[model samples]
Target: MKRSVLKFGGSSVADFPKIKDISLYLKERIEKGEQLIVVVSAMGKTTDNLLASVHDLTDNPNDKDLAMLLTTGEQQTISFLSLVLNDIGVRAKPLTGYQAGIETIGKHLKSKISSIKGDLLENLFEEHDLLIVAGFQGFNKEGELTTLGRGGSDTTAVAIASAMQCPCEIYTDVTGVYSTDPRIFPEAKRWDQISFEEMMEMSALGAGVLETRSVELANNHNIPIYLGKTLSDEKGTWIVPNDQILERKAVTGVALDKEMAHITITYPSHDRQFLSDLFKLLEDAEINVDMISQIQNQDGQQFSFTFKESDEKELIRLFNALKETYPDLYFKIETTYCKVSVIGAGMRDMTGVASKIFKTLLDADITFYQVTTSEISVSYVVDEANGEKATRLLCQTFNL
Candidate 1:
């Protein structure tokens, strides 16, 4: 029998009616002789609401207990989805991540998949036409529950598809991947297919359609992913190998990340060891820093980097501690920054892409604080207020 994995986001299966609609959709597919595995996220705002509840109880919650609390959301989703499916006369079995043999290893709330016991799924296939597994939460070797951070459900779906060697279909509210956020620029165009590399860049740079780790897994395992609207049969975007993409645009998309903050640290010492130790401190704290720039001045050397706004409070606390320890280090934090990026696979073969981006932003009267580039992407840091305008102008200039 043909096998496929279908993943539904929270918005897709938000309520009982939506779940019933999904059940009927799956029933038609199952009747066509296809054995399926279904993955689902917590219903609309369930995870967020749970997190809010946790915060309401305490200013700081234990990671282990937090993970334990969060997994219940997905559990609720899987059980509810199974109930709706069974009510509609579709034989469905619901499994938690642990029950489905998903083994992960890492700290609570940000674990990585270590391995999956495919044999367990294979055995269940004989008895159940559809296996509904909760997404985002998994078990570690220590037998602790762990959540896969934000967009973890996408990672779960791709990991399962990779393990089972089946095509993965991700159903979300959006019809497909767009050149820019359609909400920001309603004229944004969707792609029929996107290269895995380009799509990964977009996801990492804030195109929230797919998770970055999920794209990496799919790319590594040669798993083709179909992304589209949950209930519509519209032609969506296919993320596949670069060879599968027939046409490559110079600029495939524009991605905007509004939750970014910029930090600059200046120290009186010019020693490289000081810089190295500072980075080690951030690493020990599990703070991810991006788009780093270094400058040497008459007073000392300065380092600037960008990180998620969610980490701002922790980062500030760390910097304060560092100041007390170093006694000679000065730091400044800018929380009103956003990252705007242009991504495309054809960037490697193109010329003057960075210049074009700079010219467009300049013409829009937008000033950038920092600029960074990779083989397939160019990113700029600008004031959060100017992010949308910069993105729209760049989209128009590049015709993305």
Candidate 2:
């Protein structure tokens, strides 16, 4: 029998009725003799509510305790989903990540999947039973429960597929991946298929459809992913592993982020020691910097460095460290900005891509702060308020 892993997002199981619909879908597939492993996230807004409650009680809740509390959300979801499956005459069982033998390495909030002991799942598969595993929560060697930050469900599903050596399918509110966020661009088109590299860029830059880490795992394992709507029969986006057959669309998608800050530091000399110190400080503060740039003068006597807003606090700490160390270098930090990118696998071979991208924004009179690129993508930092407009124009220009 062919085995597969099915994962449902929070929206897919947002309420009782939606759960019933998904359960029916699973039941139909099971009746047809497909061995399945189902993974599910917390119900709609459960995680948000839990976070709110934690914040209300304390400004900074303990990470381990918070993870323990949040994992319960998925437990509730999978348990209810299991009951709904049985209610429809489908024999199903719910297992928490620990019960399913999912083990992780990190401390609490940002744990990574370390290992999975599949003894229980293998036995259940031998019995020809459908296994429903809670999506995100897992235990460490210390037996402490942990959560896989935001987007954990997607990671959970893909990890399970890798462990089980089967393909995985994801069900969400949208039928499939779109050229851009459909809510922002009403005309955003859906791709019949997308490559793993392109999908990773989209997921990293704000593609809401799937978690970036999950895509990474799928790419590593050469697993195919199916994205379908929970209520519709329409075939969704297929993430393909083989690049040989993958077609390159000049503009596969557009991604945007409004929460960012920009910081730049100029120094009389491009002191390697000072730069190393700044990076170490940011690392100590656990700040993630994006789109960093550095340049030196013709004489190589002075240097300029710039980075994104998400690293503001860390940058500030680094800035102070530089002041203490050099006492002469200057730093200028600013916030209230946005970053938008046009992503496509075809960009790797496409010429004049940046020119076309900029012309679209120029036609709309959109002023951008800075621009950067990867082999497969180009991104611009712009005014925060114009984020939606920027996304719409790129979506239209590329006919995404």
Question: What is the TM-score of each predicted model, taking all chains together?
Answer: 0.97, 0.89
- Candidates' C-alpha lDDT: 0.91, 0.83
lDDT of 1 at 121: 95
C-alpha RMSD of candidate 1 = 1.3
The 10 consecutive residues of candidate 1 with the worst lDDT sum are: 268-277
Residue-level lDDT of model 1, residues 50-131, one tens digit each, is 9899888998799999999999999998999899888877789999999988999877888888888888999998788999
Top-lDDT structure, candidate number: 1
| Count of backbone clashes, every candidate in sequence | 0, 1
In model 2, the runs with Cα more than 4 Å from the true position are 242-246, 264-274, 284-286, 295-335
Q: Give the TM-score of candidate 1.
A: 0.97
